[model samples]
Target: MTGTPEQVPAAEFGPPEDDIARLWTPHRMVYIGGQDKPADDTPAQCPFCRIPAGDDESGLVVARGRACYALLNLYPYNGGHLMVLPYRHVSDYPDLTDAETSELAAMTQTAMRVLRAVYAPAGFNLGMNQGEAAGAGIAAHLHQHVVPRWTGDANFLPVVGRTKALPELLADTRARLAAAWPDA
Candidate 1:
């Protein structure tokens, strides 16, 4: 007798399968739902501003400079994706003081080096989304993205499924990068 769709046995559908592994990322729903996103564009509610105030490990901070800091992206495009931003609640890159600008640039370079030392990615993509119109999720704070890429990293998943398959956890990746950070 035939069963309902829910009651259908997997073994009856096709040949024996063992190589495929599924990554169930239900946690991404929180990001999609915009849970921790600040209610308004203010330093008081900004996540970027609050991150540096807490402990580095808990904050997933890979490194901290005088004016800027680096932390893992809570919603990452790749395994070791990170962002470099100033501690001050400045929204525009041009508004950054000379010291903050210098430190941010230097830290971005360091983040690239540290990612190489840890993940040895094949390439990198770096940029900053300036405002809400430009696709900045948090237009209230300025932050630069540093994403590590590998050969054959792109696949049907992100294109067809709109989801990325990351092999490492953010906390573990943070620990590895922090440990490998220069002068850390």
Candidate 2:
């Protein structure tokens, strides 16, 4: 294995295949490459800020609050995975205004309720990734993740294959959640 690029055989680049089945998810390459990630922390570069500018269905917005909103995650961890974010561009949780904080928490609760009504998940994971060091994909704008979980949701696919198998489309999931969202 200690040879120059030209001298090394092509066989050495990749290991031989095993008996495991392959799940080709080439579409995930774009997200893995950060193709749509914002280059800067400005509001103009923030997807959360831009999403509200369009209509609800097109943006996958499930519900809208006065100071915050709920929308489906473009790259969801599960079928009903969604996010709650404040309208105003803010990075840190402490930076949120009182109204934004209130609405954000309220929307988060509503998201869980709606998911229960729509998907009837066995459990849920709710949290916010504070910064890049904490595993935040887009740390510039703070958003709380609301992930619904079933008993066997985390199967070998995500663990061994490093991919998730979502059973439903985002658009369809969005419509269901939007419809199930209680009137404000």
Candidate 3:
């Protein structure tokens, strides 16, 4: 059921696409690289590993620490798409060592601060998709999403076409947040 990736850009359309769509069950073929369930999907690589090697500004990452890291969703539910990831790549929260748990929380908190400053959101939808039943897109890797929400961030777009509208460009958001870090 595994396959290789064809490198087709998901952004071949006019407007920006929704990252959450990858988690939707019907689009698993496009999201879950073939290794998991299809004939050939992109292999899973530790995204954090790319920072030191290169691709630092790819927007897939917000920040990194000694114990854990925060990566952008590339596809996000909100303008500020981000995920708190532990370097170890374990999925279950309880399975994380006490130190990793502590670091993850601190990183998550920092991410919230950064989002608030850059996006100026009224609130956030912070959560962990524990597993398949809980909506873990990467069921094997534990991660948390920090999504900014205003009074009515949810609009007719997602409800009707399963699409989400992100205003700021990914590069712009990344630069703004990166500059606002530590102080953010």
> What's each prediction's TM-score?
0.87, 0.90, 0.72
Q: What's the lDDT of the predicted structure labeled candidate 3?
A: 0.70
Give the whole-model CA lDDT for all candidates, comma-separated.
0.91, 0.92, 0.70
**RMSD (CA, Å), each prediction:** 4.2, 2.7, 9.2
TM-score between model 1 and native: 0.87
Error of 3 at 94 (Å): 0.7
Give me the runs in candidate 2 sitting further than 4 Å from their true place.
1-19
Q: Rate residue 34 of model 1 by lDDT.
A: 88
Cα lDDT of model 2 overall?
0.92
Best by lDDT: 2
Tell me which residue pairs clash in candidate 3.
1-38, 2-38, 2-39, 2-40, 3-39, 3-40, 3-41, 4-40, 33-41, 34-41
Clashes per prediction? 0, 0, 10
Query: Once superposed on the true structure, which residue ranges of model 1 sit more than 4 Å away at CA?
Result: 1-22
Q: For model 3, give the 10-residue run with minimal summed lDDT.
A: 34-43
For candidate 2, the C-alpha RMSD (Å) to the true structure equals 2.7
lDDT of 1 by residue, 48-158 (tens): 999998999889998988899999999999999999999999999999999999999999999999899888999999999999999999999999999999988888778
